[model samples]
Target: MKKIHNYFAIVFLFFALHAVGQTKDNKWTFGMDIAWVSYSEADKIAVGGKFINQTPRFSLAKYMFKNVVFVGSVSTAIGDNQTYTTFDGAARYDFGTSQNKVVPYALIGGSFINARILTPTLNFGAGSTLWFSPKYGLNVQLLYKFSEERFSSQRSHIMPSIGLVYSFGARDMNPRIWSSTR
Candidate 1:
């Protein structure tokens, strides 16, 4: 497991650096997701906690490849103490290219979980982004989180979120509404 973690980390770093090299200009997105974290079976990384936590997740993403984007997010509770807070970093590989109005992707990432105590989490999931225009749209995601510590307060869980996404940069050569009439 240690070796696997190391390999995954190395691969993640390689792709992240490579993407920066390959990128030319404008491909950045900012998003806010309303996340509902469903605590799975007992010991779902929170020790006897099996419930759902609703949170607002803020994220920043950069498109590195034609099909890959790296996202970093921070989430916390609003008006609740039992909710979990997390800082996450993930890479998403979209099935559709940049031109599509809707793009679905697979995700893998790690998280620093703060429930009762701090723990590390490995997460995998799928999501999609729906673009209304080149600038704005909706984003949704579902993730399965696995806690690293077995004897701690950290437990496993499923998280799903929906939110708005805004894109900025030079994705289109000419940033204008696609209309025929002048």
Candidate 2:
């Protein structure tokens, strides 16, 4: 798992660095999000302890790509004392490439799962971003992770989940860069 994460991080960094150079001006988009996340768990027959599941989640993403953006965020929940960190370095495109005012983009990246019982989760999802501005918008995500936990025989919730994405940032180019253009 660590190996995959390392490789992904390396590749993502390389691509992000290369992509960032393409922008004529320095631009950034950031936002905060909150949502309900549902988790699945099975009980251990011999141990006599039941596992709890939840589906509430919260996250924030920043778009730092000229044509394609690198998204990074932290996700957390109250159930199972579980917390996850995710990095998505995917290409995002607006319908018209115009300054944001409701644009949708696709996401493709790896998610690293960290928890007590589950063997780390590395999954991928494809979603869209509805932008109100270049710096802010409503993000919708549909994600699926390959389950890798050994538990009791009983069946439980097992499927993909949907997430709400929010971005926040300034619409105007940074003043520092504007001076250089002149």
Candidate 3:
């Protein structure tokens, strides 16, 4: 498990750095998400019950390669007796277009997740996120988390999320760094 985590870390970092070099600037995406999260652990103290989850996310992207963009996102939520926060940096490939009025994208990235339990005796968590965004329409996702607790075992979680997105300066593959100059 450690090895797999390390490998994923390396790959995600590589892509994230590559994305930084490829983007131009002045593009941003903002969204909000509602989800359901379930927690079940053999050690009762490690996880709690299922709960409604809602996250508001914002991402900034810059064009680099033809269809590629570098992205940074942050999210926060309260759920299942805990409060969660996440930060991510990734590379994305845009498939559809602004002209078509529907934008589709795929992203692979690395994230830091922190969870704090409200109950004093329960455990909190800190972990990484390796996720893929198959559909960017309406800013919804099948959210996935690969997480580990300080005293508990590692786990993979999948949840359905629905959100709204507002994207700005999404014109070309490599949008001008300063539209004013253009």
Candidate 4:
């Protein structure tokens, strides 16, 4: 677990530094998600029962390039007797022009899940956003996650979520970073 955390920290730092060096017109987005999560193998042992669950998630994203965004997310699932948490970092690629009101995207990422045992996870998914206005939007996503623990040979999770996103900074156009030459 310690090693996994360290790896994520290093990766996050690298992306942050890279983002800072690249574009001055980058935008930031903060979002809240509601998801239905179903787990395999591990959930039985961890929760001591079989149950379907719901999770509330939060995420932050930075648009580092025209179509590339770096994202960090956290979610927690609570049941009668147990709780599970996940932390994830991912890169997303938007499929169409940003000017469009609706845009689809795909993402791949690494995740850390804290359950009965700490498990490192991998996820891949696709999602779309419907921007009602320049600063606010609705997002929907579906993700498949894979993980393994000593006690549980192989564990998988399916997560489908819907959320609202709030954007900060200029919309669609690059903001001027310096005055034009006279």
TM-score of each candidate structure, all chains considered together: 0.74, 0.47, 0.52, 0.71
Ordered by TM-score, highest first, the candidates read: 1, 4, 3, 2
Candidate 3: clashing pairs of residues: 22-64, 23-63
RMSD of 3: 13.7
Model 1 Cα lDDT, one tens digit per residue, 1-182: 45744663565445434431112255677776678777656554445456655555778888787678899998775555475789999998876445555667899999988777788999999988766665666888998988765637677778899987766643442233343122
Which is superior by lDDT, 2 or 3?
3
Give the runs in model 3 whose Cα sits over 4 Å from its true position: 1-26, 35-45, 96-99, 116-137, 148-154, 170-182
Model 4 Cα lDDT, one tens digit per residue, 101-151: 666789999888776667788899999877776666789999888765553
Clashing pairs in 4: none
Judged by whole-model lDDT over C-alpha atoms, candidate 2 comes out at 0.40
lDDT of 2 at 166: 28
- By summed lDDT, the worst window of 10 consecutive residues in model 4 runs over 173-182
| Candidate 1 residue runs with Cα over 4 Å from true position | 1-25, 44-48, 149-151, 170-182
Ranking by lDDT: 1, 4, 3, 2
Worst 10 residues of 3 by lDDT: 119-128
List residue ranges in candidate 4 displaced over 4 A: 1-26, 40-54, 78-80, 148-154, 173-182
RMSD of each: 10.9, 11.2, 13.7, 9.8
Better of 2 and 3 by TM-score: 3
Over 1-182, each residue of candidate 2 has an lDDT whose tens digit, in order, gives: 45744664565445434431112243443333443334443323322233323333333344454556665554444434434333323344443332434344555554444443333344455555544333334556655444444532222222233433323323442233213231
